[model samples]
Target: MEEFVPSAAIAHFVMKVKDVESSYAFYQGLGLRGIDKFPEMAIIELRGGTHLLLAAKDDPMAGALHASRVGQRPDFISEKIDLMIAGHTRADLEKYRAELMANGYSPADIAEAPLYGHDYFSMLDPDGHGVSVYTSHCGDKPV
Candidate 1:
């Protein structure tokens, strides 16, 4: 099979954000292409033209089952990470970590993942949604 940069298979996905401006800046820093920006919302385009819609939400996690407005805290069974970027190399992950650090963001150290035997790192956007960037273990395989 021919190896190609995969385009997003869907039209868009949304991240309820606390601040559009900051969220916009944050994703932009991570190399997602900027599309449109608004006071209440912003859109960042991924490699295949899929849009990551960043819309303002007073409490982005308010609707989360792990959290609640009026009830006992619940033990969450799911991860906070909503997006993953795959096509990076181990060295690319290191470079990205350094770049984020220099820009005043705290990103997790590159760690080895046994799943695909690749390295990855996680970071939080301004609104606190988790994003993971990792080396592609797909090699010549179509993913």
Candidate 2:
């Protein structure tokens, strides 16, 4: 059997948003830097390292750029894309978790997942991207 692996894996992700301005503004509030902006789309780069593309619904080429709307696509929003980021400690997880909640993003219960022995919290972005912060314990707890 032959298998192929991409050198860098995912290059970036493009998300279709109803309003680029609103989506750009939301990510900006989260400390992301806007790298590109057009009438139909806006690109925001996060501090931790990831690119976010906000594509306006009216964009003539929007359909070609995005997949089927998952969450609150055209109207209401839901968390469809679950993005997990790494945290080393509970404090690290709490820090981002609280910041997100205070900023209007509701974080689900912070709990330990037995499968991986990690503590995690989750939230959603403007376009319904599921973002999560987690601390992996690998079964060992802080003493």
- Residues 82-118, model 1: lDDT tens digits: 3445555777668767988998889888876534666
List candidate 2 segments past 4 Å from native: 1-6, 47-49, 63-79, 84-86, 114-117, 136-143
Instruction: State each model's CA lDDT, in order.
Output: 0.69, 0.65
| Top-TM-score structure, candidate number | 1
| RMSD (Å) per prediction | 6.2, 6.9
Task: Identify the leading candidate in terms of lDDT.
Answer: 1
lDDT of 2 by residue, 1-143 (tens): 55553345343567767778888887776546888888898988753456777877668877766554455355634434434434566677778777876887677878756226556766666667766656644333221
**How many clashing pairs does model 2 include?**
3
For candidate 2, what is the TM-score? 0.63
Which regions of candidate 1 are displaced past 4 Å?
Answer: 1-8, 58-88, 138-143
